[model samples]
Target: MAGGMPDRNFLVNVFQLVDKDRSGAIDSRELQSALSNGNWMPFNPDTVRLMIGMFDKKGSGTITFEEFGALWKYVTDWQQCFRSFDRDNSGNISKEELKTALTTFGYRFSDKFYDVLMRRFDRSGKGVIYFDDFIQCCIVLHTLTPEFRQLDRDQTGTATFTYEQFLLVLAKILH
Candidate 1:
């Protein structure tokens, strides 16, 4: 949601690619198919469900051109943010660069915490985070932050929550 509006043609093309059935809209199955086929970074079903709920303003259960345009812009913005923080153009961001970038963007966390985050996203064990993992990390972090904060009310930086709480959080994020 950070980039300028995407071009209509580009959105249309993306929509067409995802909407393999030519039904003029994309459903969960189609989206999963596209992701599985490597047209996307392979989001989880929960993420896909959340996205459809967020972008399908008409409550149609399928995404149209306007919805897809918004989705595309969101992805492009994330990509831009990732590229900006990558720094060395290595197609990955080192832990140091990630720390600096997050700090520049006003995030503050302990070095240990940052290392944990970086390790979680560094799937290749190469001490760097590629774009796909970065995207997943960002999405999961973004979706969970509010609920995490709500549960961690004492500012202890950690909290115990029930399975019910987890489901509630997931539902909130998806809806």
Candidate 2:
């Protein structure tokens, strides 16, 4: 709202969500759970079916971890690129809001990005992204982080991965 837009972590969030059993692969119910939980809306059978069609990249009817991962990256990147549109956090991001945010984020103009996002997330087609729409955005943000950036080969940035940018960041864990 204030600045351009803030991109949030999508895929990482979804991975934690859909992997309910912690097994990595998404069974039908798990994907349904993730989709439902992604937004605050009531779960409709038709919505679920449409989501399966959109998010399930493998056409497997169920989602695998890798497939989920891919979907997350695509969605999240789009969201990150245009998050500022949601200035009120009212679960609805308006088009003017989106344009302002993108401007602040350094993208002076991106008609294609706006068009595609509007087509997908704006269910009402009112030029605003709602809660479920935002969730879809987050799903794609999951894979935008690059492995090299994870290492920060330049050593200019922080050593630890904590914030949104660390969505795909690799962390060393101790057993």
Candidate 3:
């Protein structure tokens, strides 16, 4: 495969292995069980569901083999990204590491904002972001940045919105 992606046979084997129920697809639980946080911990269920929602083109709430290839690539790409930022190799991103990662991604946020992010994404309450939580955090930032920019017509890093407009924008993003 190009870009060092696993060959089709390897992917098929992995898909089959993760498809424990032999349902020809992998549900969130199956995916969660198959994934790890680089520390032998199961991936977060919420992240698994979010990923399934993204790749489940059929809207079946599961990932078919046909969809598995893309999902695999997505996870691997995120894995590389997380590892790159996890400089201490602790299998989790500390607040400082997260700050560095976000800054590198071109995000400009206040220390308070970073605190909020750490509190929100640090699911284990350990003041560190695990692999799945890190992915979720990055995805949120990545997805929202352009949407916010679209509203910030002057590029002043801020925008004004009516109550209705705010709801509409949030609705669009949530769906």
Candidate 4:
């Protein structure tokens, strides 16, 4: 578990709440429902599926209590990272702040590249990254960084792909 999450009872309550079928685990349907409810933040089905796949250590097609704990820790860490770079505490991160945060995480993205990222994740059209948007950004960055590097073999920190190559890359990233 991540640091400072000493509230075991609270965690248990949340786990139970999410375990909608009382099956002692959370499946993809339940997890997707919880994430997409727009209660805390919004997550698309694909991202939620990837998240579940990441934490389903037993390969059981569901997450047990122990796995849920790990997921909680992971999300908490993301939240902490977002808060740290959101220096104004305005519940949003500007494009510049996002660029800096990603840079700190070792992603040397160009301004134009970051703009493309913003367009993809910033669905709210508010010109700032909210919690949900930030989560998706982190997911995409963590999951697709290797693929991005492979495509950017020239070390230019940016890659341009043909329509066919773009589809191929998208397929790789989503699955």
TM-score per candidate:
0.70, 0.39, 0.89, 0.76
Choose 1 or 4, whichever is better by TM-score.
Answer: 4
Model 3 residue runs over 4 Å out of place are: 1-3, 39-41, 168-175
Please give the lDDT score at residue 50 for candidate 1: 61
Estimate, for each residue in 1-175, the C-alpha lDDT of model 2 and write its tens digit.
1223223455556667777888766665665555432246554343344455566777777666556655555444544454446677655677667567546644444688777767766776567766555555433433233443466767554355556545434231100
lDDT of 4: 0.77
Clashes of each: 0, 14, 0, 0
lDDT of 4 by residue, 1-175 (tens): 1366547788799899989999999998887666532335555666667778888888888899888887877777777787898888877888988998988988876799989988887767878877666777787778777777788989787897788977776775576
Kindly list the per-residue Cα lDDT of model 3 for residues 1-175, writing each as its tens digit: 1245779999999999999999999999999999988666678777788788889999999999989999999999888888899999988999999999999988888999999999988888889999999988887777677777888999998898788877876664355
Q: Rate the local accuracy (lDDT) of all candidates.
A: 0.75, 0.54, 0.87, 0.77
Top model by lDDT, which number?
3
Query: What ranking emerges by lDDT with the best candidate at the front?
Result: 3, 4, 1, 2
Candidate 4 C-alpha error for residue 41, in Å: 5.6
* TM-score, model 2 to reference: 0.39
Model 2 residue 43 CA deviation (Å) reads 6.6
* Candidate with the larger TM-score of 3 and 4: 3
- The candidate 2 region of ten consecutive residues with least summed lDDT is 166-175
Candidate 1: list runs displaced more than 4 Å. 27-62, 151-175
